[model samples]
Target chain A: MAGKTPAGSARSDAVRNRRLLLDAAAEAFAEGGVEVSIGEIAQRAGVGKGTVFRHFVSKDELLAAIMLGMLDELIDTASGLTTADDPGAALKGFLTAGVQIFVRDRAFCEVIGRPSLQHAEVRAAIDRLCDVAEQLTARARDRGLVRPGITGTDVALLMAGVQQTAAPLLAAEPQAWRRYLDLVFDGITASTGRELPYPPPSHLSLA
Target chain B: MAGKTPAGSARSDAVRNRRLLLDAAAEAFAEGGVEVSIGEIAQRAGVGKGTVFRHFVSKDELLAAIMLGMLDELIDTASGLTTADDPGAALKGFLTAGVQIFVRDRAFCEVIGRPSLQHAEVRAAIDRLCDVAEQLTARARDRGLVRPGITGTDVALLMAGVQQTAAPLLAAEPQAWRRYLDLVFDGITASTGRELPYPPPSHLSLA
Candidate 1:
């Protein structure tokens, strides 16, 4: 492996640079806004502006990449949770992960929060997240941990609730989301036996 | 009244046109987005473009007016609740009104949903809303209807959660917010007795 050709190392270097740029961009956008310059992002990544453009043609594309990357990471996390010994804990953990992401990526939250402004990539990511959520929630229900009559849409609503409600208070209380999530978990867990109001929310049908 | 002078009728006509333009702009903005053209809005209002220009100097001002109008309506609604016989019911009704507003006014929802984008008018509205929410929640708490230890911020989070989660589903099912609101209502009500997770949310400082 040490004797690998220059091209192979160059390719690996490119991958590392791209990841760095995405991380840098995410931070810059979250800290400032979408208006952060590409050159600034490249500077943060310790790469040339040409290298940044080489990875993502435009800032919008860079934003899309970050969103897709977050969704892919979420999907990976959700898939891995299937093996967890406690389905209930896995479900709770999934929601907590979502809240953390919302807190971490204000840019991503801004995009997902508005329907009028969402691009195709954002919708795709939400659909994929919804699928993963449905799977884990089903497992929790099967284990008698999650309350009956709760749907994937309800789970989506709960995670979104935590995100939107907690994001603003992060400066004053970083862990505000945790408390809200617990109240939500208690409400939805089987122990509560709480019946949701009639005529459930619009089915988040990905079909 | 029928014998009113010509000048009096002309003044009434100006007032009517202003109301028409505002209502039309609100509908157009909510239906399409904040980008809806003034000419298009005037067309919807059955008025000329000059009428719109006469009422609003620019689109930014128009948006501000709409936001202030919403806040004024919300403050009015909240104030009216003090007359209700049941404080708990009044508090719940206030939240329900919020959901209905979010469902009815997409432009308003977009404005209120993002803390970063909010201007002075929106912040003032939220501050007033928080005050009203505290008053109603305190009354409800005294009546043993609202659960213990819930603050105005908690109530705000719950309402924001419902509005954010339910806004997207309005197209598929208009009453979708009602279901989620009920779930939230249950969680916060005395019947649940559900202890919130440790380290509660940031204190919503009204002082």
Candidate 2:
């Protein structure tokens, strides 16, 4: 049991180290964007750079991991809203949660166009996010809450658009995104019976 | 006249070279964003690298010049729309022209957050653009064509937002931004009388 105790303790230490690294990396990147270095992240986590390298190979790898976690959280948020009683409110809730992530994490917004977005796992997670968004959008469509011809991809694109548009003003007006989100929501939910000038993109291609 | 001819020829030649450089730089940057090098732009312009440096001190200066041109064009377009017969359609036309510039010029979209945006002349041009946009919005609001509380700054941001949202898919669908523009236009025009959740950003600060 003495030998087994040493092994178990090492495993727990590794698990704790990884968790700390992720949290510290997230905070550092959120504040400084993708340019935050691994050394800085390690220092912030109170660990050595070796610990960070052991957990993640490169900065891109670390960013992809962080993005994957964010995607999972958003996916879960969207999933929960799937059973919401009011479809419009549910869709709005999902967008609110999604944009809030963008607002809080500058790295997430900055990384959208970076090469790390091409990472296989990150791409798959984005695909899953789109699918869940589709479910919510479809629910709203069926209830006639959103206008005709609006697709999940449109909603997904608009969600990011709101973030990009508000990004320049985020420092000055942190809640500015809410106004754009409301504007977009009103746009999508508009019942004026107007048709979008173009069809939705056939698929989600973040890269 | 013969003595002045050589000096005049050199002056004319310089003007022609500057025009060629600007046109070539615009095309190159539009194709490759701000990363397109001055040497490449010179090559595209059929000139020496020295020619680019002589005309513009740095890439940021060149980009600011290009942005100044675009802002001037947009300001002119908005100015024309202010007195149009249909205020709503006029505002839509302004958005269409504005988003089209973003769709065609990738550098324009990419440079929105770069240091070039901080250039004094470019910042003043942007201010003038916001003022003209406000005029258009006010014209529409007075006629009750657009909802209350919509500002020119709001329109300006949403125009950029549509372009950002459609950027990833532009390679596959170049006209995709029209749909987003339509959606946003509908949102601003929705007569459903929903008030925005936040006030208009008090001022525009693109940096």
Candidate 3:
């Protein structure tokens, strides 16, 4: 701390405050909400309220940091799946990984849908994650495992669709997400051995 | 307006205030957050501050009513699908119908992972909806139209999955849900000539 220039000292303080704020914000948002007060966060971080304001600039900025932390874990885990030996397995693994992550971080899930956050950087992250989903679908198609018409975007929706039942406060059983996964997979995975007994759809139409 | 009994008149007033408060709260919650004030809701509803309090025990109760209104429509539409002549058609029709209803009321979507309102009645309504979803799967399966291994819960999750993409805010872009439906139908449908070109999975692992 002694030899550092004023600028260097400021940079180090910023980094320390960033981690402290993130940890504090995550706990608060989970228990209260993204609207949890900056004062409460400063108190929880054991820093002066002025220190909190200096670091985040605004409440929106602090919320963004908390969400970024959550998204980082999701992106990193999903990224790992893209490197798995089997493409289908990688995609499935990522879905499961995402589910667990979402379940654990309700605050992140609650705010991830905000259109205001649709900045260039967020869009890039989305596109990269989407590419991961696409690779999984392409791999399945190439291996002759998935059905004919499915696309990567389809898988993205499918991922989002399944997570619907995983609402944190539905007051059902905790394993509701497991049930959601089973059904979602049933909707995508090809039926290999068993012949479906149901009648064929007369036609497929969006109407 | 004058013909009603004293108790009946009070109930009617209560209902009107409830509706007014709910409309205001829904708008506020979507624009702001759950921390939105009762006074703001009263102003939005063009009612006295006392009227808002008279109808709702708390802001939480007002939010719950909004959620219930949306769920009621979903449960009714889904249940109605079972009565259609072609179970397969009914399944698709109702699944799509349910998604439409869900999309029509995006405000309710906000309540998913948020704090609980009251429990007893709210839980019952949710269970009723789950039952409708389960029934959609069972009936679809019974007709031999859904895959052999698929269940009622499967259909519910599939619909919910679509909602995740075709959500209220993103309502204009419903192609995600459509693509998801295609994947779902392809996986579970009895193969006809129009099948997509995915490889048959060797065996689906429970994972």
Candidate 4:
């Protein structure tokens, strides 16, 4: 109680306000893209416009923070996955969860890929994702669940393909993306584990 | 032969000049992206700047014409496929060729997605593409080469994914896209012919 002075209370209050602002900003941006106004985000967080600026200097900065937050969530999800038993299943599960995050958070999906946000922090976040993917993929390959020569970059690109391809389909047929994901997973799995749905390209031995 | 007057010679010269300009423009745009200047294109085609404007009117107009030309080429290729017996193979071949076209022509890829270029003519060219895809997809479905419930839009979306993902990879590894396309194709093939690599998503039966 002696250490809980006025300064301590103010710092705690600032921390709480920051969390509230981030949550409100995420919701606002998800609903109304990255172009959502600072005033709207402040109002949603039950704070003044100045408070929003106090936490985030600009909209781009706010969007970047949101992106970093999402990446952290994805990284945590990947890290928490238990893959010692079935590495393939773990990889698929992580990719599924990641794609779902992209689906639920359109603002994160849109803003992260913009030319302006390709800074070091964002790149580092993406590299962290690739690191997790590489770990999962390596385990799967060792277990003979995944095809040989399949790199983490391949897995990452396939998951990105699913997210990017599934964006428009969300409006008309919400679940159509699941079909494509199934295809991609099956394609990448070792031929011995699952029968290929078709022959590989004639010139290349995909197996 | 009597009709080969000076006016006729001039008309033939104009026609030859137009063809030369288009070929030059295509080469310049493919090499230099959408930002390539009209003067550069004209110089490449061995014509004066005035001649380039006389044919294309503007850079956008030139780009549109190039797009239309590519669409015509695609439509012709699709129409020529002998799909009466092996529709699935035909469909796959058409998609593979289409992706190759996008890879070879960066300007076409860059301009196709621009909001401003979504005019009636461009829309018509795109619709023509969809029409061919639908025809091929329908044939494949009848033959049961592709999985059930795979629509023409799905085929189109997959091709777009190939084009989109392959764009960046082209700079590093030209043939890298073939790997993803192989995965996609194998995934979509009938399970009766090829085994699935993994269990389909639990929520949906991917038959």
Per-residue alpha-carbon lDDT of model 1 for A1-207, expressed as tens digits? 111133334677887886798789888877655557888888998999988877776677787767777778977898898779998899988888877887777676666655544557767777877777888889999878877777766776677777666656666676777877776676677354557666655344321
lDDT of 2 at A136: 96
Q: Please provide, for model 2 over B1-207, each residue's C-alpha lDDT reduced to its tens digit, 9 standing for 90 to 100.
A: 101123434677887888798899989988887778888999999999998877777777887788788889899989988889998888999999999988888787766643334577877777788789999999999999889998888888777788878876777777888888888898898887668879888755544
Q: Among all windows of ten consecutive residues in candidate 4 chain A, which has the lowest summed lDDT?
A: A198-207
Candidate 2 error regions (>4 Å): A1-17, A35-52, A113-117, A204-207, B1-13, B46-50, B113-117, B204-207
DockQ for each model: 0.39, 0.50, 0.24, 0.17
User: How well does candidate 3 match the true structure in TM-score terms?
Assistant: 0.72
What lDDT score belongs to each candidate, Candidate 1 first? 0.72, 0.81, 0.58, 0.68
Candidate 1 CAPRI classification by DockQ = acceptable
Per-model TM against the reference: 0.79, 0.87, 0.72, 0.67
Question: Candidates sorted by lDDT, descending order?
Answer: 2, 1, 4, 3
Best by DockQ: 2
Q: Which consecutive 10 residues in model 4 chain B have the weakest lDDT in total? A: B198-207
- Considering summed lDDT, which 10 consecutive residues are worst modelled in model 3 chain B? B198-207
Candidates 1 and 3 compared: the better one by DockQ is: 1
lDDT of 4 by residue, B70-167 (tens): 87888889888845457878988988987787678767655543324444576577667767777888888777777766666566667655655444
